[model samples]
Target: MKTILELSMKSVTLAVVLTAGAALAGCSEINGVMNDLQTMTTSNLPEQGIAQPTNKNAVSLKTDLVGLVGWFENSCGFDPVFYTEGTKENQVQKRFDTFQESFMAKQYKTDGSYTAYVKPDYRSKLPANYREAVKNISVVEDSTGVHYYVDFNNATYRGYDLSRLELFYQPESDYVYDTLYFKNANFVDLKSVFKTTRDDLDELRGGEFDAKSRSVMCYLGL
Candidate 1:
C-alpha cells in the first residue's frame, strides 16, 4: 500500500512540475515581447516588414505640385501632366476663414497676355475628338479676355479617360472634390494629403488656405 501511495504522489508531483514550467515559459515569452516594443518606442524604429512614407516636404511650388499631380494622375503611381497653376476663378479649391488649398497657376500660363497656344504637355494634351471648346468650359481670364480652357478629359489611361475632377472648399469644413455639374466626387482628402507630402512651398504656392491640420504623428512615430 505504501509503495502504491508513493507512486501516486510521484505522479502528482510530476504534473505540478510540468504546469509550473509552462507558466514560467509563458511569462518569459510575454516579457520578451514587451521589451521589444519598448525598444521600438524609444528608438523610433519601424516594426519589421512594415512600409514607411518616404515623401518629404517639397522645396518649391513646382516640386510640390509635381508630387501632388504625380499622385493624382494615376492613382499615385506616375506623374500626371494635367494640372496647371490654379486661378481665382475656376480651379477647384478649398477656402477657409484663414486658409485655403488648391493648385497654383500652371507653369505654362501666367498673369500676362497670351500670344499663342502654349506647347502642350502630357497633362494638357487631348485628342481632337475630345478637344474642349471655350463656350463649354470654365477658365481663368484677365481683363483683356485672354483665357485657356482646360480639357478635363486630358488625363487618360488604357484608352479610358478619367472623369472630370474638381475641388471646392467650405470655410466651415474640409476641402472636397466635385464635378463641374455639382455632383459630389470622392477623392483624396487634402488634409491628409498635405501631411504626407509635407511641402515647404505650400505656404507661398499662392492659392487659398485651409484650416484643418491633419495628424501625421503616426507616420512620424510621434
Candidate 2:
C-alpha cells in the first residue's frame, strides 16, 4: 500500500507568495496546492474530540468550530486564507450524516472503524477555469497500481485561501490530516528560504552527480 504523490515538477516545493493588497489575478490559480498537501498526509484530530451526542447536532458544533476558526483569525493576526481555503465541506457533511444514519437503516453493527468528515477542496476559491484545471488532475496508479499524480504547473499560487475539505473514511493513507499540517512544518519555510540560496546548483543537473567521482569534485579543477 504505497502512496506515491508525485508533483511531476521534479521537485515539489512550489509556493505562491502574494504581497499584501495584491488581489490574485492572471495566475495559475495555485488552487488546492494546500489541499493537495493535506490529502497526502493523515490526521488524528477528529478522533480526539468529544463525540457529539447526536450526529445531527454535530454539524452545529462543527459550524461553531468553523466560526471559532474565523474568530481566532480576527482575534489573532492569523491569516483567514490559511484556514478557510481547501475542503469538500458539503460532501463531508453529507458523508457524516450518511455514516450516522446507516447504522439504523442497514441494520448492521456499528463499525467502530468507520469514520466521516469533510476535507477542504483546495481548488474551491480559485476562479472557475483554474478549478477545472485542478479537478482535471487524474489520480492514477503505476503498472504496480501505486497511485500518483503527474504534470501540475510548477507555479506556487500563493494567497493561502486557495484550499480543500478532506473527509477521512480510513486512516492509513500517507497524507497528513491536521487543520494546518501534521507537524509544524518549519521545513516548508526552510525550503522557501533555501529557494534563494541556489548559486550554480540550478545550472547543474543530475548528470553532474553521475560525473562526480570524488569528494574533491567542487574543488578538483579550481
Candidate 3:
C-alpha cells in the first residue's frame, strides 16, 4: 500500500506532465497560425504586384507578364530587349546596338519627342491597383497557339477602353519563338505601331532595322 505522501506526490507529477503537454500543444497551434498569416501577407504584398491565379496555365504566365510589365514601367518604355522574345545573340540586340551608335553620333536627331511622348502618358494609363487589377488571367489554348488574356479591370486610356490584353505564345523547345502582342486600349494593335516605327527608322538611318529598337520607338511614338 502507498503512503498518503507518495500518492500525493504521484498525483502532482502526473498533473505537471499533463500541463506541460497542453502548453506545448498550444504553442504549436499558435506557431502554425502565425506561419500561415505570414505566407498570406507575403503573397499579397504590393511590391510583388501580382495575385495568385486559379488557372494552372496562368501560374507561369502571370510571372512572365508581371516581369514584362515591371520592366516596361522601370524603363519607361525605353528598354525593349527585355520584353522582346529572343536570344541575345539574335539580330534584335545587334540592330538596337546600331541604332544606339547612330543616335550617339547625332545621325538621328530627336527634339525630346520620344521622352515627352512616353514619360507621362504611358505611365498614367497603367492600372493604379496593380495587384488586384491583374489578379484574374484567362488562358485559351487552340490550334493557333496558347493565348493568355489579362484584363486591366479599371485601366483605360483616352476615349479607348482597355478591355483585354492578350499575350500569344507558341511553345517551341522551351523558348518564346514569336513576337509578343499587346492590344492597347482595345483599339490599337501595338504590333502595327512597332512595324511603322521600324519603317520610319529604316528610312531615316538606311540600315538594317532592329525589331527590339522599333518596339521601344513605338512606345516613345518616335
All candidates' lDDT scores? 0.28, 0.26, 0.35
Q: Can you rank all candidates by TM-score, best first? A: 3, 1, 2
Higher-ranked by TM-score: 1 or 2: 1
CA displacement after TM-score superposition, residue 68 of candidate 1 (Å):
8.7
Measured with C-alpha atoms, the lDDT of residue 85 in candidate 3 is 62
Per-residue lDDT tens digits for candidate 3, residues 74-106, read 232334453466844234344333322221211
Clashes of each: 13, 36, 0
Weakest ten-residue segment in model 2 by summed lDDT: 213-222
Error of 3 at 91 (Å): 23
Q: Is candidate 1 or candidate 3 better by lDDT?
A: 3
Over the stretch 1-222, how does candidate 1's per-residue lDDT look in tens digits? 001111245764565566566786666765675577456444543233222223221111101122122233222211122233463211221121111121223343475533323243322332222233111333343443333333342232222223333332222234333222101222223323322222233321111212232111111010
Could you estimate the TM-score for every candidate? 0.21, 0.18, 0.27
User: What is the descending lDDT order?
Assistant: 3, 1, 2
- The root-mean-square deviation over C-alpha atoms between each candidate and the true structure, in angstroms, is 21.9, 24.5, 20.5
Off by over 4 Å in 1: 1-68, 71-114, 118-140, 144-146, 154-185, 188-190, 195-222
Clash number for candidate 3: 0
